[model samples]
Structures are given as C-alpha cells and as structure tokens.
Target: MQKPSIPRGTRDFGPIQMAKRNYIFNTIRSVYEKYGFAQLETPTMENLSVLTGKYGDEGDQLLFKVLNSGDFLSKTEENDYQVGSKALLPKIAEKGLRYDLTVPFARYVVMHRNEISFPFKRYQIQPVWRADRPQKGRYREFYQCDADVVGTNSLICEAEIIAMINEVFNNLQLPDFTIKINNRKVLVGITEVIGATGKEADFCVAIDKLDKIGIEKVNEELIQRGFTQQNINKLKPVFEFEGSIVEKLQFLTTYFAQSETGLEGVKETQEILKYLDSYKLENDHLELDLTLARGLSYYTGTIFEVKANGVQIGSITGGGRYDNLTGVFGLKDVSGVGISFGVDRIYDVLEELDLYPAETGAQVQVMIVNFGSEMTASGLSLLQKLRTQGIRSEMYPDAVKMKKQMSYANNLNIPFVVLIGEDEMKSGDYTLKNMLDGEQAAYKINDLISKIKNSH
Candidate 1:
C-alpha cells in the first residue's frame, strides 16, 4: 500500500501546533477588534473573474484554479485547447481558491454594496491558497489575518493600520521588527525622474526583488526588462540612500520636484507619517523605505511591509492603499487601505525566536483521572461541576491503566490533574496533582476551581 501523505506545501497541525497557532490568531483578532474592525468571512473559493487580473500577472498565475465539476472537458471546444490556457481556463474552471483576503473582500463589498456601511471596517481571519512553490514560511494553504476599511480615501486608515501592526507584534511580544513604509506614486515619480516613465510595472517587479537578489542582480533584471543603464545609474543613488524618515522624505521632495504625480505620492506619504507619529510607535521601528515598491498592481498610494529584525524570513505583514480596487468591481471611486498578517510566517518567526508563552500549549486546565467504572460516577459528578464553573476540565474516556491515563494527560500538556477515589469521595476532598512539580494536595471543589484558575 502506498503510504498516506499530505500534498507538498501543506501540513497537518497536531494539538500542540494548533494551540500555538490559536495564540497568534487570537492576538491578531483582539487587536483588530480593539481598532473597531468587525469580523468577516469569505468563501474558500471565489469566481475566477473576481480573483483574476486584480493581483497582477504573476499573482494570477499562482491562483489554484478549480476544475469545473461533472465532466469538465465536455464543454470545451477543440480549438480552445489549441489556443492554450488563456482560451481554455474559463471554459474548464470558473472558480479558484482565493489568493488573498483583500481581493475577495473587494468582491464582497461590491456584491453587498448597499448592505454594509460606507467606510466599512472589517477583519477576516481565514485560509488562503496559492499554487506557487512553497518553502519555509511560505505555504500553498495558509491563513491571512486581514483588517481593512473601504469607501474612504482617508490617510488615517493607513496610520491606524500601522498602529494596529505595532500593537499586534507588541502583544505577541515580538520586539525586534520594522514597519517599512513607501508610496507607489513615489515609485512612479522615481521612474519619471530616471527617464523610465511608462515602465512603472516593470520597475516595481524588478525593484521588489532588490532584497532577494541584491543591487547588481536587480540592475541586471532592470536591463533585461528594457531599462537603460542611465535609468539604473539614477536608481542606484536612491537605492543606497541612508537617512532617517525625515531625510528620506526630504530626499524625495527634491528628487521628485518636477514630477507632479510623484509629488502627490510624496504628500500622501507625508500625511500618513504625520498622522502616525502621535501613535508613538517605538524609535526606528517605523521607517520610510523608498525601494519598497509593493508589486501588487492594485496599490495606488502608501504601501507598507514589515520584517522581523532577526528572523531569516520574508515579510511577516504587508498591505497598501488600493484606490481603485473596489472601483474595478463597479463600486466606482471607493478607496481603502488595509494590512494582512501572514500567520504562517508569523508562527515561524515566533517558533524560531521562542516567543510563545509557556501557557500557550496548556489548553485544558485539569484532567480528571479515571480509575474504573466503580469510581466513574464520582468522577462524572466532579467533571460536571468543574465545567459548570468555567474550568476547562476533561476526564479520560476509558477505564485505562493509571500509567496510560497519566501519559495521555502529560502528552496533552494538561497543567493539573484531579484525582477522586473512594477515600476522597468519602472525605469530600479530592487530591489535585500539579503536573509541573509533581506536587499533590487535597482540595474541595471550590478550592480546586480557584487553584486551577489561578495557576493557569
């Protein structure tokens, strides 16, 4: 028989893994809520029309398209196959697993335009899929914790989003991280100044790879993409510019003096930065990065990317202002800004840095040990009482060996164990074992509840 295995780039999270993941999700959810973002959910699959052309050519290629059900090939024309995927994809696959939360969100807003409040604030925590090659911190199936506000062009949303990012990592106790901010308009301005106008998309695609491929390689890519060596030579100074946020913004002011569109992007970025200062994020944690041209074609204004200072991973969080995203779906002129927390990558960073608190793995507060059928009745009564008092307690289902039952509790990382026996039932006190130090003490029902609650 062939050994059973999950598809590559996917994983089956065990109890402990689930517990840690929940920690990350709950932290993000709490922050999203505190900032007035309500929870929202989108279907796992979105129409291919809704999913495509919004995320740029590369993103469209990575979409996990679903085959149309019930003899999918029956409807296809013989000539469509000769023309290839461009002609055949829509015939065979009308739906695709959502590539990200943002696009699906735009679709939702358009579909329910009248149902939701304008400048709607919503947060969605759910899995997204991609067909790209996956490695550490990148997965084909993973969750994105997203918070967004639509139907407004306010830069306050951008500032608030950055503040939320700060709070999330701060709550997670991830101190060493940077929030890199940039503007897509500034990128356009740079292209114009360097005489690379009309090649904005190509510039973003190449410059976005600067961190991964380094400058020399990036210059090579720029050349390959039809940029002149003069254009690259002008870009070199901008790439290597070192300064504080003020200095960087100043540099842009002078560099983009002649490009009106570039100056507009610069102004929008300045407004966002000014609004963010009152939030008082830590020194150097928020930075102005000129080279941060977020590759998503939809982003029209301020763009943000976050990196864990010490971890060797890609951006843990990123998002930007999409002025025309909803407009693409027929909600004309509605603009919004948002951010997404890459949960898989965040979990990887937490694991590598040992940031998760010790209590994260202890899901159940106490486990009631099972002796046999003889004592099962007393155990049942105690279990119900503990649960009624809001204690997370469970009992072993089987009348297994004492060693075996304790092994189960240990494996589950149960912090405490409650023992009720003939003697204890008669005495009206049960022995509680502290799993950490192997200490045993007798306690009544009320006392047991207090101890478990206090300890955990």
Candidate 2:
C-alpha cells in the first residue's frame, strides 16, 4: 500500500489546537453577534463564471479550479483534448473552490435578493481555498473571519467596522498596533493629480507594497509601469508626508484642493475620523495612512489594513468598501463594506509575543489515582462525582503503581490529583494533591469539589 499522507498546504488540528482555535473563533463570533450581525455561509464550490473576472488578475491566477467530474473528456477526441487542456481548462472546469467570503457573499446577495432584508449585516466564518504556494503566514487553505454590511451606502458601516476591529484586538489583549485607514477615491485623486488616471491600478498595486518593498523600489516600479518622473515626484510627497492625523489631513486639504474627487475622498476619511474622535477610542489606535492602498480591485471607497507593533509579519488583517460587489451579479447600486481578520497571522503574533493564555492548551483538570481493582472502582466513583461538578476528572486506566500514576499526572500537567486508596475509601475521604505546589490534604468528597471549584 502507498504510505499515507495528506496534501501540502493543509493542516490536521489536534484537540488542543482545536481548543485554541475555538477560543479564537468564539471570541470573534461573540463580538460579531454583539453588533447584531447575522451569520451566513456560502458553498465551497461556486460556478466558474461567478468566481472568475471578480478577483483581479493575480487573484484569478491563484484560484483552485475543480475539474469536471465523471469522464470529463467524453465529448472531445482524446489527443485533441489532451492538446487543448492547457487552453480549454477553464471552460471544462465549470466550478471552483471559493477564494474568499466577500465575492461569494455578493453572489449570494444577487441570487437571493428577494428573500433578504435591506441593509443586511452578516458575519461569515468559513474556510477559503487558494492555489498559491504555501508559506509561513500564507496558506492555500485557511479560514477567513469576515463581517460585512451590505445594501447601504452609509459611512456608519465603515465606522462600525473600524470600531469592530478595535474591539476584537482590544479584547484579545493584543499589544500595541495601529489600524491604517485609507480611501480608494483618495488613491484615484492621487492618480489624477499626478496625471496617471487609467494607470491607477498600477500605482495602487505598487504603493501597496510600500511597507514590504520600501519607497525607492516603489518609485522604480512606477517608472517601469510607465509613470513619468514628474508624475512620480508629484505623488512622492503624498506618501512621504507623515505627522499627526490632523496635520496629515491639513496637508491633504491643500494638496487635493484642485481635484473634486480627491476632496470627496478626503471628506469621507475625515467623516470616519470625526466618528472615531467622537466615539473616542484610544487616539493612538487609529491612523490616516496615505500609503495604505490595499491592492485588491474590488475596493471603491474606504480601505483598511492593520499591522502588529514590533513584529515582522505583514498586515495581520485587512478589508475595504466595495461600491458594486453585487452589481456584477446584476444587483446594482448595493454597496457594502467588510473586514477580514487574518487568524493565522494573529496566531503568529500571539505566539511570538507569548500572549496566549498559559492555560489555553489545558485539557485535564483532575486525575484520580487507580490503586487496585477495588481502589480503582472507588476512584472511578469519585471521578464521576468530580466530573458531575464540572471538573475534567479522569483516572489512569491501568492499576499502575502510585509513583507511576503520579508521573503520568505530572506529564499531562494535570493540576489536581485525587488519591482514593483503601484507607481513604474506608474513611469516606480523598487526598487532593495540588500538582504545582505539591500540597496534599485529605477532604470529604463535597469539600474537595468545593475547593476545586472555588480555587481553580
């Protein structure tokens, strides 16, 4: 038989990992619920037509297409089909694993428009697949924790998303970080002022890497993309300008004064800022970053990306406003803004910073001693009573020696051990040992449960 193995870019999460992941998911889910957003899910495979031409060129390349099932070449000559597979693959494969939740949500909205309420607020926690090469933080298969508000043009949704992001990181007790906010229209304004309108895509894509690739290389990329020296020079100051959000907005007022669209972008950003100020979260938590041009093509108005302080990882989370995500599906004028939390990256930050609660992997809380057949029965009875009290109590299956049982408990990091030998059984008591401090005491069953419940 072939040796058993799973595919690359996939992970098998064990109990402890699942527990930690559950903790993360539940925390995010609770926050999403608190904001009154309902949950929604889309299928893993969507029609190829719906999925394609949605994500931009690079994103389309990374989509995982599903081959037609059951003798897919029945209609074609064998040799000709083999020859044409390279060109005809997309046509033959009519479905694909979804790339992200946002696009699929758009498709869902269009298909179910009649059944849904307006200004729909929904949260989706689902696994999305990509065909890209796997890396430390980037994976071909991973989960996206997404929350989007659709069918409304109100900037309140944008502010709510910002506040949601803030609440999530804050509740996670994440260390210092900043939520970088920008507007795509502001990007368009920059392109217009610099005389590079249609080339806005290229400009946005290049500057999106300013954090990763630096400004020098970004300029070189712009020039390579056919931007003139004068254009690059005009756009360079917008990036190089750094100060308080107030100062930056002031500078932008003068810079984008000539362009009406740029001014509107500035106004939208200021409105979000004013909301931020009125709500008055930690002032340091939000920043107006001119360089934050998230490269995704769907974003139309506001854009957001978050970075962890003192870490080398890329943006830990990002999302933006899409003016017509559903319009592509024939549902026009339905605007939406959403955000996705990069769970894997957040896990990496927590691991590096040692912020995960030490008790995160804790499974067993109490272990009972199995002395002999009779003592074991007694121990089992006590274990049942402890478990009924909500303690994760278990006994060693074998009638192991006392020292061996103790060693087992120590290895498992079980915090409490209950000794129920013949004497303790006869005395109607059990010896509870605190593994960490090695303190031992004999107590009645009720007293033991009370102590464990109270202390632990």
Candidate 3:
C-alpha cells in the first residue's frame, strides 16, 4: 500500500489550529461589521477569463487553472498538443481557482451592479489558491480576510482603511507593527522623471523586492529590463532618503518639483495622513515608504503593506486602492480601496509568540466523569442542566475506570470535571475536580452550577 501524504504546499489543520484560525477570523469579522460592512461570499472557482490578466504577468503565471470536465481532450487534435502549455490552456481549461478575493469581488460588483447600492462595503473571509512554489510564510492555499468599499473616490475611505488596520492588530493583541504606505501615482511620477516611462511595471516589481533581494541586484535587474544607468542615478535619491513621514513627503515635494504626477501622489499621501492625525492609534503607526510598491497591476492610487514588528515573517496584512479594477469587468469608473489579513501567517506569528489564551484551544469547559451504569443515569440529568445554562459540558461514553476517564479529560485540557458516583447520587450532591490542581469537593447541583460558572 502506498503511504498517504498531502501536497507539499498545503496543510491540514487539526482542532487546535482550527480554533486559533476561527479566533482570528471572528476578530476580523467583528471589526468589519462594527465599521458598517456586510459579509459577502463568492464561488471558489471563477471563469478562466475572469481570473486571468487582472493579476500582472507574474501573478497570472501563479494561477491554478481547472481542466474542463468530461473528455476535455476528446476534440483536441495532434496539432493542438504541439502548441505550448500556455497556448493550449484555453483549449482544455475554462475555469480556475481564484487567485485573490479582490478580482472576484470586482466581477461580483459588475454582475450585480443593477441590484446593489453604490459604494458597497463588504467583507469576505475565504480560502484562495495559487500555484507558486510555497515556503515558510507562503502557502498554495490560504485565507484572505478582505474588507473593501467601492463606488467612491473619497480619501476618507483610505483613512478608514488605515484605521481598520490599526483596530485589527490591536484587537488581535499583536505586538508593535508598522503600516507602510505608498502611492502608485508617486511610482509613475518617479518613472516619468527618470525616463523609464514604459517600464513602470518592471520598476515597481523590482523595487517591491528590494527588502528581499537588496539594492545591488535590483540595480542589475533595472539595467536588464532596459532602464539606463542614468535612470538609476536619478532614481537613487528616492531610495537613499530617510526621515519622518512629514520630512519624507517634504523631500518628495522638492524632488518631484518638475513632475506634476509625482507631486500629486505626494499631496494625496499627505492628505490621508492629515486625516489620520486626530484618530488615536491603538497598536500600529503608519510610515511613508516610497519603496513600498505593492506590484499588483490593479493598484492605481495609495498602496499599503503591514509588517509585524520583532517577527521575521512577511507582511501580515496588505491592500490598497484599485481605481480601475471594476472597469475590466464592464463596470466603469468604480474605485475601491481595501486590505486583507493573511490568517495562516498570522496564526504562525501567534504560535511563535505564544500569544493564544490557555482556554482558546480547549472547547469543553466541563466533562462529566462516568462512574458506572447506575451513576451514568443520574449524570445525564445533571449534564443537561449544566448545558441548559450555556456551559460547554460533555460526558465520556462507556462507564470506564476512574483513571481512564480522568486521562480523557486531561488530554482534552478540560478544566473542570464533575463526579457523580453512587454516594453522590444518593446524597444529592456532586464532587467537582479541578483538573489543573486535582482538588475535589462536594456540592449540591445549584452550587455546582455556580462554581463552574464563576470558575473561569
């Protein structure tokens, strides 16, 4: 028999991991609702046409396409196989696993345009797939908890997104974090000034990897992509400068004096920060990072990425403005800005820091200790009473040995155990055991409820 194994890039979450994941999801979902956003869900598989090209060239390459059902190759000829895989994909596959939530949301907006209100604010927490090589902090399948608002160009939305980012990390009890902010317009303006007009995509892509690959390799990549040495020289100062957000924007104002677009991007960044000045930040601070280019092709205005301080993992959350995303789906001029929380990476961070509460993993608060057949009959009535008052309680099946039942409760990390043997049943009192300290005491049914309820 062949040994069973899962795909290398995927993971199977056990009960504890599921509990932690739900904690993360519920935290994000509650915040989304508090901010007046409704929950939305889209199908796992979207049309190949809908999924393609929205992500840039490299992003498109990572898409996991689904093959057509029922003898998909029956109509293909020998000539069809001669064409390369890229060329022949359309012939065999008409659908694909969604790369991210934003693109599908765009498609949803266009299809339901007539039925919904403008500037629809919706939150989605679902799993998405990619075919890229996975490593630490990167997965083939992961969940993206995204909240977006469309149909408006208000900078208030941008400020609100920053506020949301702060609230999420704060609620998660995450340690110090930095929210890096940038503007795509600023990137375009820099390209125009440096004479790399047509290479904006390449410039953003290489710069986005700056922290990963370092400056030397990024310079080499620029040359290979047709950027002149002089262009790099002119662009060198943008990477070299460092200061406070206000100071950095001031420098950009002076540097982009000749470029109208660059100056506009700076003004927009300034305005967003201005709006954030009055709001009290909880756990994060925003920074102006010119090098923070989130290389997605759809981002048209402000771009954002968040990194957890003191942790070596990549951005735990990220998103930005997509002014033209809806246009491709036949809904013109509807702009949207949003961010996504990477739940898998966040889980890894929480685990590394040991931040999860002790009670988080253990679902049952109390377990009824089964003594024997006679004791089991009376235990059921008490068990239902405990459950009726909304305590998470369960009974071990099979009236087994005392040692075996105690071992079962310990394995589950159950905090409290109730004992109802023949003596307790006749006396009309129950013995409760504190699993952590192993102390047992007798109490009436009403007193048992009070003790368990107040224990936590």
**Model 1 TM-score, all chains together:** 0.97
lDDT of each: 0.91, 0.86, 0.90
Tens-digit lDDT track of model 1 for 1-456: 999999989999988899999999999999999999999999999999998998888888999999999999998999998999899988999999999999999999999988998989999999999998988888999999999999888899998988888889999999899999999999999999999889999999998998999989989999999999999888877988999888988888999888999999989978988898887766537888899987889998999999999889999999999989988788889898999999999999999999999988888989999987678999999999999988888999988888998999999889899888889979999999998899999998889889888895
Off by over 4 Å in 2: 1-6, 76-86
Best by TM-score: 3
lDDT of 2 by residue, 267-290 (tens): 998888777666777643788898
- Candidate 2 has what TM-score? 0.94
TM-score of each: 0.97, 0.94, 0.98
lDDT of 3 by residue, 360-401 (tens): 898898999877678878889888999999999999888878
The most accurate candidate by lDDT is 1
